[model samples]
Target: MKALSSYLTPVRACGAWLLMTLTGGGAACAQAPQEATQDRMVAKVNGAPILVSDLKQVTDAQTQGIRYQFADDPTKLANEMAAVKLNALDTLIDCQLLADEFYKIGGVMKPEFLEQDLTQIIQMGFRGDREAFMADLAQNGLALEKFRELRERILIMNVMRARIAGTVEVTEESLQEHYEKNLRRWSGPGKVKLHTVTISKKTADARSVADSLHTKLADGGDFEEIARKSSADSHATRGGEWNWLDPTDLTGTVSEVVLATKQGEISEVIEQLDAFIIVRVDDRQEGDPKPFESVKNEVTKSLMDEVSKGRIAERMIHLRAAADIQRMGAD
Candidate 1:
């Protein structure tokens, strides 16, 4: 794994496992076992066989989620499970394809690298309990060496991604285009810009004071001026001004008052356990569209991911086209 060390960073969790799934290697296991044997070849990629048992290992967790989601409706679970098995097989096939490519290029994974990763997996994934880790592998019908092989294949795919991502750069035009095309995703939640005036209820005449302040505010008094002289909230120094905030951030009845208040209008005194508060709605924004300049860095990263995924998807298509991919049973 000298090349692996050179190209790939330390592998954590793989979050891009399905970057090349559309290339094929799918079969519907929602029906029946392809054969009475558990080792039936569900797919063959470049003359290499991927077994049904291997497919099941990949589908196990996914099906677990689906099973829980549709527990009350067995029919829906079965229907979704059929597609899950198919997609899981595709993902496995893609992994195998990448592994095959790695070896074809004379890439070799070192045994020491495998041992290091296995040690780390034991430490991180199983709290250094090697016995528990071994038990888990055994229960899953995975031998120690086979599990390492799986990990090594994953490392190879990650290295491939690292290489691809490194080679690709985000262009300014592409970044802007991606952001504009996906405006809804880039848009922000509804938010309000607000200022407040607070009167401490601890004062014996707090309600009377709050009422007089509200009357003054209603008689064209400047809310900020009145707040600066009389308010008790944390923002009093800045005339009770607050940064643009999500309405939900206000919490409970406070949010309700803020939402119902019209922009530039002073709200009625809102009574609280320890304070009497009045809010002025400076501004309100719905589905706020953030400027591109404000979110350029985030958009750039998203664009790069899209670019990397596109390239990997293209690679998968080419690999499938050049290889002998046989889908066993119904796909």
Candidate 2:
């Protein structure tokens, strides 16, 4: 029996089987006579039957996270499960409608391509062991031929999406508009690369030392060299240089002096709580708004996503309206 490869990528194939493995498919594989009679329809699209088992498969995959989240609350779990099942059923109905439309609208995909993709998926999912792959199918109660039909239908839906939603392109205007609308996201805070010279209050002439250092800076002394020789701060070993400091990270006289001082210039002696110090802005960068060229590709992709979402919703509505769709039972 041929496996349906078109609907599943190598990654998605593993994901499907992983979910099946976690949920355990023994019940589906061992249906009793009474269980077979109990099987019921959940939905129909253009007379194509969607069974409860179909809804169960989709909802089972979706509810894994929810189950983990509400494991302790049976009431919440039941409510959430009902919502998940309803949403999954609606999705399956739309998928069927789109698939039917895809064939009607002349979509075509070669079987050879699907077969090749399927081999890759199987190799990835079961380490290229055909027996393991088949065993998994048996455990999941999925016949090879039935799985192929399901995959073909899913592939048709994908083709419909490519024609409708995937064709959308983001315009330059839209990209620019998105960039402008979200300026803060692209802008960074102002930062300063500062170097300092300090004199400890414990030093008998701390004020005199600070004053002399300020004068040396004014007289074209090398700030780093002078700081290394005389500064008494934590950063003295690194020529009293402080890495880029954000505005909010500084306070008191240091903040006032640093903000007021021009880049590449030194401040006059300023008294701190227990020391006299001087600061110099080694390098400062004003937070400039990100240029259009820098974020154009990202903005374009974001705009395209918005357009694609709208396109899919619009196409689904059009397809559902044009097709004969009926929902039976709980959703």
Candidate 3:
């Protein structure tokens, strides 16, 4: 499975900053000698220099995807790039303003949390190659120290969320209403308690192995024992027992075969990827609506999620209003 960071790309938040830094002429300004560039300013956020190098990195990273989209049309590509650059600059200025406000409001990550998050990001994003990841960040024109500061700001935003959006509660009446409205979707044809054995073609002749198991089962041999000895599945060690899974949860062919069988009956050798499977329907239950009392907790959790989303949205609006936001080139 891909790591969470690999999918979410939290590092892209810093990429946003890098985009603005590059397009806002921060890179060129940074390259100029300090003595000669003393009076020159690219852009400023509450008197802090938005360096030329910072702008270049951010713009370069952010524009990479846009560049690909318009690869076939240079004129359209230039227009898109220009728009992306302006938007990126505005976004960076807003982010910096928010971070400044976040600090003012006593928003900060605990040292331990910062270290743990950084470790997780490194492990998930860089696959434990911290030095190489740092080098890549440098090549993208991001400073390790500045990126850490950005991470800290993000952590603080989360902290603000926790402080503002407290616990959510779901009422029993709302849950009952939802249950009544959506109960049809949960109903099914029936349930099956199945005993299954799988043999991979790589390990043995699938047809021969399945035939042997069928004979053993017919002779009243221990089903679990036969499964343990012959099945090539990872679950073979546990006697090929799959906890009573819903037919709907099973793959199309497996579901069709299992649903067709009667209790105490076995399936014909069913072919799957690299293997043949034998399934026995041990027990069955027809689908029925679960009593409201039985699933009240689940219903309550769903309602709470809805309430939490609304509260978070409201909180974000308030935070944005109270924040001292000044966009450098928004006009």
Q: What TM-score do all the candidates reach, one by one?
A: 0.54, 0.50, 0.41
Q: Considering every candidate listed, which one attains the maximal lDDT? A: 1
Among residues 3 or more apart in sequence or in different chains, the pairs in candidate 2 whose N, CA or C atoms overlap within 3 Å are none
- C-alpha RMSD of candidate 1: 14.8
Q: Write the per-residue lDDT of candidate 2 for residues 1-331, one digit (tens) a residue.
A: 2232223211211222221111212111112133434558866778777777666654554566566666654435666778876577777776677656655544444566457545765787567887877776675565665555555545555556655775666667878888999785566658989988888879987778778778889999888898889888889889988988785577454676787788888887777656778888879777777888987877787777677768878988888888888878744
Per-residue lDDT of 46-162 in model 3, one digit per residue for the tens?
555554544554566656655565565443466668986776555455445445545555444445666667776777677888886777667555566655654554444444444
Off by over 4 Å in 2: 1-38, 61-84, 182-292
lDDT of each: 0.69, 0.66, 0.60
Candidate 3 residue 46 Cα shift, in angstroms, is 7.6
Write model 1 residue lDDT over 179-273, tens digit each, in one string: 98988667755889998999997877999999999999989988788878999988998988999999877745577778778888888877765
* Native-referenced Cα lDDT, model 1: 0.69
Name the regions of candidate 3 deviating beyond 4 angstroms: 1-105, 110-113, 178-302
Q: Model 3 Cα displacement at 253 (Å)?
A: 26
